[model samples]
Target: MTATILLTPAVEERAPCTLPPRLVLAPGETTPVLIDGAWWPRSRDLTAELPALIEILDPLWGRITRVTVNPTFWPVIPRKVPVRGHVVHVGWFEAEQDPHKLLLLSYTVGRWDLLVIPPETEPAIAARLMATATDPSRSLTATGLIHEAERFRITAEEAVGSDSLREAVWDSEGGNDARRPASHASAGAVIDHVPSPAEGR
Candidate 1:
């Protein structure tokens, strides 16, 4: 969609701030970023590497507030009843990239969304996030790159089942339930005997 940038007070005061970076969308408008560079594909590897990535980027930027990775359901209609399926593992990092503004790095599985918001731009944050997910590279900065690594981790984790679910499944199979039998028949046998939708009538 449209390019969006958010600048917090910390970033707004900085001289490095340029024309707010446009969210890269069109085929020919993409920024040249090395996606496969430095960062690992696995979440664990990325998590392990985050500290270093932040350290390397911090001096170039300003101060990093926090890096957060969580599942988020972005509602197309804010007040709608039946919201759509969620876009999982929407990763974010809030950093003071400049003295007068805040740099927000928002990313998901497909793309990165960057925003440079002035201290007073809090209300427009959601719109800015949506824009960043469309294209993250246009806002490429030292802080943004650090966040990309974490976003990659979040994406990788979403691909697999959650630890809690995995543990429950594993524990059930390893415990007494592992020996339990079906009340009727095995799944394969049940499938073989299933009636067609038409036959049920």
Candidate 2:
């Protein structure tokens, strides 16, 4: 197994807001697959984004005691985040962690891996990705699924100017082609181990 460096920075605990996260899970029971679902967070702020996710997932999959993510996509990697009444430890592995995936550990459900879709992705593209990631027949890893999605993407021309101008142009281009964006596929790593309570905490 690849070694992971755990970081436990002292972070202030706050109440979970219980907001909904853009997530889609594979139908049926969990099975052996590279990715079990996909999550498209609104932003790269881990501290702000995680509580809502934890609130939605805990009751269904059991209390998530630990969450591991790659630091590449997230700007702020907190040591721990509060959800409900408990704390969830967060960790990161530079080398072996997939930048496009998030690994969650729950004592009841075991380990779960999810594809981390880019926040700026268009809604149409993101919806397709969510469907692909949760398809039980598709066993692609987070990276694999992204590459597959890129194959069908049609990049829209860049609108050079103010943000308002960009939005105006985006609104005017009302066609099927307008819904796509440039490919965001990138290289990522794989993680296979779930740390025991004694070692993870």
lDDT of each: 0.31, 0.75
Please name the candidate that would achieve the greatest TM-score relative to the true structure.
2
lDDT of 1 at 57: 34
Model 2: number of clashes? 0
lDDT of 1 by residue, 40-148 (tens): 1112221232344334333433333343321121111111111012111213322312211122232322322222222223234423433443443544542464465
lDDT of 1 at 95: 37
> Please, what are the lDDT tens digits per residue for candidate 2 over residues 26-108?
87575667888899998877777888998889988899999998878777677778777888888887678787999999977
What are the models' TM-scores? 0.20, 0.68
Question: How big is the positional error of residue 174 in model 2, measured in Å on the Cα after superposition?
Answer: 25
Flag clash pairs in model 2: none
